[model samples]
Target: MRPGLFASPRPDNLGLHDGLLAPAPSTPNGVSSQATDSKHFVAPLPMPTDCCVSAMEKLHGIIESLGHAEIISADDGYLHAEFHTPLLGFVDDVEIVCNEQEGVCHVRSVSRMGHSDLGKNRQRVEDIRKRLEGWGYCC
Candidate 1:
């Protein structure tokens, strides 16, 4: 349970549907079974997973040319990058998602500074992706 939202993690005996609330079943132990449907509460979100070191190198150069540093963060199934660009003497953060196997990446600006600058930087991003493809990294 999130802080300041509930007294405890106990399931609420009320079910919500179409904005209407209804009572939920109580378990044999007197615990509310509302948590039984908690599994449905978390819906999977779309994620990009196609990325490769070659593509990462391509993106690194693109951001580097913009006076930024590319930081790669990877796990077993995900490869994410955070681009730290110097803006107004401070670092601006940008996020990148990629599928390591497909060598494809979806880049986005997660910070305000990067978002505002994205419109004018589209060509640069495209250039990097194209370069990566020319080198045989493809999705």
Candidate 2:
């Protein structure tokens, strides 16, 4: 499994061609329809446990500093974070998606209500990214 390449979920049904703009098995019309959806996608596996843990620690620190953010859920594969954002004047639930194939993480701050309003939740994401870079997680 590469970063974004996926195998056909059902090769027998031409399902793979249905999702491809240039159909693998071209039609008589000689013009393939643009496919916009895929039935399946394979993601790269995570790095070694030690490497993953090290990166996670770096991410943890960034979230903690943001607002004592508590890790709602975390595993070697992914991490879900929740914390108060002074900038937004509210608590936000952020999802940090990681790809072990390359040991890379993508953090997206999702809106969550918790005794405050949404302000600069995006900024918190930036801070987290910078810290990850500092911690050597490929940013």
Candidate 3:
């Protein structure tokens, strides 16, 4: 398939709101640490023992190391990235927000267009979790 043949326009609600990332869509194409439903819920990443800024920096580095990933915006305690599938260039938006008081990083990953992602979003988040583990960070 041609790259980005199925790419959809980016969603307007793509950032944190009132200190929480936007909820995952009702469809199965997304997953969120903040979601109340089991189908869309994933445990948040535990913040690194260091500071929020340091954790965000490490998270940013890990995302950059993943080929085909693009950093959209990054702040002191928040990050947003887009990961493109190699074959179709399907875009998946991943957002992370560091809650220092809670000591966890809220995450959400969703396909830009699709009814089902076949677990892609969940897998991507798991992959990130593993990479963070390699950095001596644990859940």
> Which has the greatest TM-score?
3
Pairs that collide in candidate 1 are 49-98, 49-99, 50-98, 50-99, 50-104, 51-99, 51-100
| Residue-level error in angstroms, candidate 1, position 63 | 4.7
lDDT of 1 at 45: 15
TM-score of 3: 0.92
TM-score of 1: 0.38
The root-mean-square deviation over C-alpha atoms between each candidate and the true structure, in angstroms, is 16.2, 15.4, 2.6
| Per-model CA lDDT versus the true structure | 0.36, 0.44, 0.87
Tell me the tens digit of each residue's lDDT in model 3 across 1-139. Answer: 2347667677889987787888899899999999999999999987854578877888999999987898989987889999888877889999999887888889999998879999999998999988987885532
Candidate 1 lDDT over 51-106, as tens digits, reads 45545555555555654444444433323333333433323233344444443454
- Taking all chains together, each candidate's TM-score versus the true structure is 0.38, 0.50, 0.92
The candidate with the higher TM-score, 1 or 3, is 3
Q: Give lDDT for model 3.
A: 0.87
Error of 1 at 69 (Å): 1.7
Total residue pair clashes for candidate 1: 7
lDDT string for model 2 (81-129, tens) is 6554334334445555444555445444433322222334445655665
Over 4 Å off in model 2, which ranges? 1-50, 85-89, 113-119
